[model samples]
Target: MMTRLKIGACLTLDTLPDHRDWIFEADRDLELQDFLSHAALTTDRDVLIERARQALDGFRGKLSIHGPFEGLDIDNKDPELRPVITARFLSALEVADRIGARKMVVHSPYTLWYQNNLHSYPGYAETKLARIHDVLGPVLRRAEELGITLVIENIQDVRPETRRAMVDSFGSDAMALSIDTGHAQLARRMSGAPPVEDFVRDAGAQLAHVHLQDVDGHADRHWAPGEGEIEWSAVFRAIAECEAPPHLVLELRDATHIPAGFAYLRDRGLAV
Candidate 1:
């Protein structure tokens, strides 16, 4: 029998206060502050490595790492902020290397400016393009040398052209795409963004990872497969048709949801 697609949780090892505010209510006993601090400190790398290994035990699926999403900026214009981003990525890399993970997911710096702005100004696209090259150039180059794959994700209607542009600029097999399903849904609903299949195809040779989640037309719900209205069968079909099957990560909030999601994929004959 063919194996199932990998299902993994996003570790909010160092989330921002605003995001953690909701997580507290979702998982009351998680001790968010302590976990974040522990993940931030490298003295505990072995412990973190074991935790990830344990998390994947008995599972015959590939593993991938989601680096610190909160307060991480690969495209920061300030020289001071670059090291902070690099350190966070390196920490995640250490854990991933320990667990034999093949891909590390990182977001562009769009969230920093797009959070408050309601309008899409003229020069915004050009500005973000320049920022992406400046911020991710060194990091992507180093990732190539280190044999680590860095997959850049799209957020808030980041144009497909821009995504293609960034990957072409890097021109390295180590650099690729991480397509977030919910984010793509949100972009389609809110901004009339192009279809998910189109994005995947456009990404072409650089598409290396995927984040699967279900959401309504509004906020990201992160619901289990078949629990929400997403057309998962279509999504999987698109993935199957890709030139290469990128790593498919469930990106669920909880581990409890993983079994059901796996079952759903199995029932659809997509486990392989």
Candidate 2:
């Protein structure tokens, strides 16, 4: 049996717009119950486990998961908010455990605005990171107990130095790098840092997961592979050269685009 690369989508159950737009829309519609209703109707733990089994039934591939993206803040500074985030993280891990997913992706929860606006705050990044470590430490310990891998992704304009700092602070192999292709593209465009491939190669030893998507040199629209402007072939080559290739998860915004993405990888002789 030929080995296939694990292809998974982010936990984007609803079609909400970008974060900024969502905040503005929410402010306008105070009575909007659509968000809660949508969440209530989507797959629960049991349902997700079954779905995972069904999705991977015949495919000779590894399994991974992208945890819920919305309304989760692992780096919240508020003491009252920490438990809620921790609970959600554990719940996500439960789903991963049920589905036999080896890796789960998580974000630091601080947006570009939060970082930029708080530049004057004392120990800004350190405080947030330490809070994150405190919140994630137990969750990761539990994941380790359950034999699950948690991969942290870099988002917004967070510098590579900060990324490395966050990862090192976590202090575990379970907490490794999850390179988001679109985010890397955005970083390169804005900062003129090394290309995405270079970042992946430099973090090769610590890479544990990847979020595959395309961006049109501006925003991360999560376009299907080859639809936007990412060099998919070069990415595959980089992964192939890694000491241990990270699990590649297709973080497309839409499920309908998954098949085409898989086909593109297949055409490149990369398992999917």
Candidate 3:
């Protein structure tokens, strides 16, 4: 059986038109990245949101936005930081709501240190998890009310299961898991994490979205699918078992390479 999933693109207004025709499918997501810009989310908020709104005027495909994540840890322990982080997230979700997005991508905070030490340090897991729920609680309620799902994407995560556990704790449909192929590759190389393919199977049905990019396994190169060392076939095979029918987003560092990346998957009969 062919699990031919639709491939999508992560784009800014500047690159959206460049890849617009290629991203015409209704289920093929266009992950907007402009909102992730600090300036765009803060002082220039309306201007950039209007720019994005205008750029998406005629497109009817599913939409998802990369939420603002730079230093905005969802589970920050400092009480003072919680509201600040909460406010920033809600601010970004407003953009998501305005853009008619059903999904938003947020970064994960799991690390190898946490994975190894959470048990050793009593109440450590609870502290972080409580912080997460407290911070994300409002944003999640808004996301659910707006019919949006916040997919937790892996970054420096060496432990996918722990992240999954964290996602599961929310016990809400508005929360799910996301895997960044390039991030997984980097984690595998630097921290002895499982292979990128395993990350997919590990996320299983809760996997709501994916960021497809290739890396040299040394750094986040974010190259087109075939431009790096990733095994595309193995990755897609793993993706097929995901019951969420996860949104496969081509999140290249160079957005212009999207067509080539999509074709690489198509030529190999990996994605539809």
Whose TM-score is greatest here? 3
Model 1: CA > 4 A from native = 1-38, 41-43, 53-61, 110-127
Candidate 3 lDDT by residue in tens digits, 1-272: 65777889899888888877777645467899988767888999999888888888877777899999888999887999899989899899999999788889999988888878978988998888899999999999999888899999999999889899999998899999999999999999999999999999999989989999999989999999998888888899998877657877999998878888888889898986
Question: Candidate 3: where is the Cα deviation over 4 Å?
Answer: 25-27
Task: Indicate the worst ten consecutive residues by lDDT in candidate 1.
Answer: 26-35
Candidate 1 vs candidate 2, TM-score winner: 2
What shift in Å separates residue 122 of candidate 1 from its native position after superposition? 7.9
CA lDDT scores, all candidates in order = 0.63, 0.65, 0.88
lDDT of 3: 0.88
Q: Give me the runs in candidate 2 sitting further than 4 Å from their true place.
A: 1-43, 50-60, 110-120, 191-193, 263-272
TM-scores vs. true structure, each candidate = 0.75, 0.75, 0.95
lDDT of 1 by residue, 1-272 (tens): 33344333454443323233322332311111112333543677677666645644443444466666676666667778777766666666666566666667777554424533526676665666666666666666667766889888877644665666767777788888888888877777777777666677777767788777777869877766777666776677677677876876566666457557757877877753
- Which residue pairs in model 2 clash with each other? none
Better of 2 and 3 by TM-score: 3
Estimate, for each residue in 1-272, the C-alpha lDDT of model 2 and write its tens digit.
Answer: 33445454443323222222322322211011121222422444565456445644443345566665566677777888888777777877777676566777777564556546676887776787778887888899988898888877877644555666677876777778878888888877865656777768767778877778888878888887878888776776777777886766667777567668767877766654
